[model samples]
Target: MVKFLLLALAFGLVHAYAELEGTWYTTAIAADNVDTIEEEGPLRLYVRELTCSKGCNKLGVTFYVNANGQCSKTTVTGYMQEDGKYRTQFEGDDRFKPVHATPDNIVFISQNVDRAGRTTNLIFVVGKGQPLTPEQYEKLEEFAKEQNIPTENIRNVLATDTCPE
Candidate 1:
């Protein structure tokens, strides 16, 4: 039974987390996102077909970073809870909390797990021109504050990048 279910996702018969899988890009230049490589493109996340199997199934979140026209990738476990929410890190940074996401975009907040200090938000336009809605901004405002970053910065980060034509 597990093999069958896993095969379904592997063969495209199922979209385990359709909303969470995609090439999400952002020009947000804080400390915790895809800011390490500036000239490439927005940071991206894509699903790994086979990661782990369980009730909800373990989703693999791969970050694609392009540097000098070459893209390098890394995989991270995106755990999906029963409520259908995914909790993953921002490129291995525990400072960034669970991925606040939607099919069109994501709102990721970065606050140290220990809560000693530091907060930042990395919002992305998952699809072309699919910027976070105004309501979404209002939604993550507290997270932005808790991360010690100004809400304006979230807007700026998500808005700074545009897909190349």
Candidate 2:
């Protein structure tokens, strides 16, 4: 019975990951360190796509970053851990957790520890083509408060002119 239950649980997790795959747009990004999400900062990411393996044990993120008035595309792959978090090495060692994910929306929180041992907490809220609704913004604010990320640290990437459509 225990083995059966474990198998069921694994299936459920894999299914959830499959649903997260596809095109996505960045609505907002928040960081505990403002510099990290500022202009030309490594954490200022605008998501373009998310893909998952057949088993959902691996995840891929394709995103854009603005540097020197140019938009650069980058892809990062993450391996799923037993604890349900995805770990990747990009601009640092990053562990990402999808706090909320549905067919239309996704919210991910990540912790990044750089080579210098500087830690940064990040939150990314994304959706399809539409921007975040008011309620989503409210929830993001609550999350920022809980994570101790300053209100001013939240950025609306779509509002910026640097990134391409």
Candidate 3:
């Protein structure tokens, strides 16, 4: 009877913890060099996907939080659209797995190595929320027009996502 009770308790605890799965909207906030990056593009739109059984284990595409308080990414890929004029591919390796993830916030660290062997470590704390609404999208269109960034480019950026609802 004690063993059965213990098993039930374990199952309940596991169920209470939320796993990082499903599609999530992401925006890249420049930790440093914000002026240059923001002048080019103020925000980025991307997606994060996680696959885990009881919780995320191996082969998860999104971030994971280990027993310790460290956030890491299993796989990270996205695109950046700047000034509504240009779209560039952004891809990198996620170094820190997620230590804690929730609908309101996500924390992770990523280490990226460029072709030149230069390494960049990016720590991301993102807010989980819905993408821009139609009105906001239209506003961005106007902003892109004034900024000389093609509206089409902005539209493309806003359309990118992790999965279809």
Top candidate on lDDT is 2
- Steric clash count of candidate 1: 1
Q: Per-residue error at 155 for model 3, in Å?
A: 18
* Each prediction's whole-model lDDT (CA): 0.45, 0.86, 0.40
lDDT (Cα, tens digit) per residue for candidate 2, span 1-165: 999999999989888878789988888899998898887888888888899885867889999988888899999998989898999998889999899888888999999998899999999888886777888788889989998998788887767635655
Model 2 worst lDDT window (10 residues) = 156-165
**lDDT of prediction 3:** 0.40
Q: What are the TM-scores, per candidate, against the unseen true structure?
A: 0.43, 0.89, 0.41
Q: What is the full ranking by lDDT, best candidate first?
A: 2, 1, 3
Which number leads on TM-score? 2
Clashing pairs for model 3 are 64-98, 65-98, 65-99, 71-96, 71-97, 71-98, 72-96, 72-97, 72-98, 84-150
* Tens digit of per-residue lDDT, candidate 1, span 1-165: 999988876766234344544455552333243333235533332212224345435656554555456556666665655655445665333333335444555554433222333333443323334455567556556665665555554433334333232
Between the candidate structures 2 and 3, which one is better when assessed by lDDT? 2
lDDT of 3 by residue, 47-143 (tens): 4654444232232445332222333334433221232111112333223344336565454434444444545433343435545556645654554
Clashing pairs in 1: 119-147
